[model samples]
Target: MDLSRRTLLTGTAVAAAGPALARDDAPPAVLVSTWDFGAPANAAGHAVRLAGGSALDMVEAGARVAEADETNASVGLGGFPDREGHVTLDAVIMNGRGDMGAVCALEDIVHAVSVARRVMEATPHVILVGEGARAFALEQGFDTTPLLTPESEAAWRRWLETSNYAPRANSENTDWPGGASDHDTIGILGIDAQGRMAGACTTSGMAFKMRGRVGDSPIPGAGLSVDDEVGAATGTGVGEDILRVSGAHAVVEAMRAGLDPGAACRRVIERLARLRGDKIADHQVALLALDRQGRAGGFALRPGFTYAVTDAAGQTRLVRAESLFS
Candidate 1:
């Protein structure tokens, strides 16, 4: 791999022989997810794969781990609420066949990804929002529960003191002064042994954001895109900019145009850099991709971005993504 186009963390390799390894040597099944928390998520997803689950099952199983984690303030039940203390969630699920479903600005739903799947499987609509989404979830047998925990409520109260709503670059990956890290979304992609691809993305949106704010996570092609013949991609970070460029779809298209997964992700980040220029320094964005051959790569606008990968053999590793401004 060219150093200019792809950079790997010191002492970390995307695969034992790196991403450029021959296709025949690629793992029979592969799972990749955004952020350090994704390591365990991948493990959870891998268990599904080991049980003969499809790519769709792997992605969904993986996402549920983070969504149920109360310590993870960026996703699911314990996520930080909006300015009004409303904990709205967003999620999307996409299959390689181009079918997708999403939910945005949903309240009191812990597993928004499952609701997204229900939307895809049960409804003619591609999306459901707010009250409609909650109703649909209830009709689908999903229970409504209070998502706000004491820890998150305390964090929201602390933010109420200053009421400063400035977006911080990599805030999801770092510790705040008086509170736990206000994390971001979890995006998981998988290619099963049969080579089918699928992806899922779920988030609580930006911490202390305006009520009803929806980010890229719930939008297909922005947060996630999967093409069985081409590849799959998903993103995290400042979703506004990611959505503006259809970040995940762009990476998959680049892979179709012949770029490796890493280079494809880098291409999109470079475009974001040019579009935002110096302003890009104020926020963070990152993308992770998996080709049909089970190869994977990731890139970010700033450092400290990490992703987790698990192969067919059940080996898992956390990789610090290469960044443009590192």
Candidate 2:
């Protein structure tokens, strides 16, 4: 559906440095995510928020929804395997107070977002990677298991038919080519009972990626970022393009500088196009943002980019994001 700015921003959120549209004492609230496929995650996160959980709690819980999904080759266990047939994961979490944690090049663990939270609440470090991330997951009580699923295996074999290591922008992992970006991440932002914000970003990196390749999913300020005083942002599409300018952080900074949620997102998209020059034509990069006051906006490099929103009234919808190329 075409969501007007009013419809996109419809919801009550926590008290933030910016003026909120709703009352300060608003009880429960809405959540926003990077992809149209994020409704399930938004539902899960909203359920947790309804039960009085922290926004951080809901954000992690919500991301777990995507982690467990096998049909979506872009994320979690069912994701497309690396060129070596390994399914490595990357994830990050940013809490209300600006504390952050991440896991990169993680293997076998289905719930990478939870492991990221452990790094935030359990360790003094900001990131854990490779075998170290697996160790942290093991110590945190996650059982080791093979992440490669039957569906992922079948897809990998299909890719091997060509045996072409040369990658296309959106040709890998998905059923067909030319829709979404290759490096898509499930990114979510939520505000709970308390007037605070938190967010999560998780992915299986790029499909058929090189062994040990880690995308922006586990990188703060690239895949996701939250500032209670200003707002929050998440990204999908080309991780490399997102990382160059720390896309999410840039959006938050724009919001802080007086751009509303939508305007900030559009400005970031413009910047991405300018910085990347002609490279972005073959790929896509999207940014989604929500201000402390509950205003939201999204923009993308290509024609097809959509974000999900679940409002206080429990209505969830997929809205086509504004796109420069469209």
Query: Considering every candidate listed, which one attains the maximal TM-score?
Result: 1
lDDT of 2 by residue, 109-170 (tens): 99999999999999999999999999889988998778899988998999889977653444
Clashes of each: 0, 0
Candidate 1 per-residue C-alpha lDDT over 1-326 given as tens digits, one digit per residue, 9 for 90 to 100: 64213444341443232443232444533998888788788999889988999999999999999999999998999999999999999999989997889999999889999999999999999999999999999999998889999999999999999998988787754553112353489999998878889999999899999888888989999999999999899999988989988999999999999998888999999999999888767798999998888778888888767777778888776666778885
Worst 10 residues of 2 by lDDT: 11-20
TM-scores across all candidates? 0.92, 0.88
The number of the candidate with the highest lDDT is 1
TM-score of 1: 0.92
| Candidate RMSDs in order | 3.3, 5.7
Q: After superposition, how far is residue 282 of candidate 2 from its true place, in Å?
A: 0.7
